[model samples]
Target: MDLMALIQQALEASGKLRDLSKKLEDADFKMILADLHSALADAKLESGELKIKLALAQEEIVRLKQVIEQRDKGKPTYNSEGVYTFEGEVGRFCTACWDSDERKMRLTDLASEFRFVGQWECPKCHAGYGAKDA
Candidate 1:
């Protein structure tokens, strides 16, 4: 069973024990029940905290697995033309983002009037590349 379910059960049991202890008239038994209830409450609190940490750790593991899958799918090839492209993709990828960040951000062509005739820019990093760099 999961920690969350166990914690919930412990909470319910503790409540029931508290009610039973209230109805009991014997002093010794009441004191023992109170001690057991306190320990159960403490365990429940720790279990709930552990559940949160476990969830965060599971999320991080999934994120790392996705990064590994992206890397294993295929390595982007360098054309040495100031850009990178995947094996089956037609769009040009940003060299800086791919090499430095392992990202596959596409490069956008700039208008000749605004920049050079064959200038391209990375939308994410804003790195500019010209045809002369090839």
Candidate 2:
């Protein structure tokens, strides 16, 4: 069983032990039982705090794993179009943007937007890709 559950069980068991010890006539022996119950209660509280910390750490681990998974999937296949193309993503991406900044900025075909036909450009970095590169 998990440590928190085990601690809870221990606290329950100690409480019952203290209750049963109330039948004894000796005062000093009953005081020791009370002290033992107090320590078990403290242990239960400490276990609860530890359980919260463990949950937060597990969440952090999941977040980091998702980042790693994205990086692995982001490995693009370079087509004959002189640009990087990520899976399930439309259009070509700038190589300089990915290499330098790890950003997947889409490259705009200059033929439709500008005077430079048969050329592409990165909007963020302004890096040009000529038809000769294709």
Candidate 3:
């Protein structure tokens, strides 16, 4: 039986045992009933703990689904120079870093006075590509 069903049955048995014990006058029978009630109480408590853990597991599943959906919506697209654009975002990223390592490393503009001026360089892999002049 499921934990919840077992808990419900145990609680019902405990209540019935209590009612039966109240009508009895023998000390031995009363003591046995008391012990059974205590055991049922422990069983119910353990089942409650399992129920809480089950709820937490369900919540974790929902959170993981949300992460997967977000990743799907934001998956990047790369161009010929290996620059990438994400959905609904303005800036471009380095495709070398993303394609090779799945890292979204942004490209930095090359030093203005350098030979590679007007180009962007990947901070992660040191790859360079010319900027799109828009």
Q: lDDT of each structure?
A: 0.81, 0.81, 0.78
Candidates sorted on TM-score, descending = 1, 2, 3
Q: How many residue pairs clash in all the candidates, one count each?
A: 0, 0, 0
lDDT by residue (1-134, candidate 2, tens digit) is 98778878877888887788888788887888888879878888888888899899999999888768769876877888778999988988898888885678898878665535448889998887755522
lDDT tens digits, residue span 16-96, model 1: 877887887888977877787788778778887887898999999998998898798799887767578798788888888
Candidate 1 lDDT (Cα, 0 to 1): 0.81
lDDT of 2 at 133: 28
Best by TM-score: 1
Q: In candidate 1, what residue range of length 10 has the lowest lDDT sum?
A: 125-134
Model 1: per-residue Cα lDDT at residue 125: 88
In model 2, the Cα lDDT at residue 71 comes to 92
Q: What would the TM-score be for candidate 2 when compared with the true structure?
A: 0.51
Runs with alpha carbons beyond 4 Å of true place in candidate 3: 1-6, 23-26, 68-84, 87-134
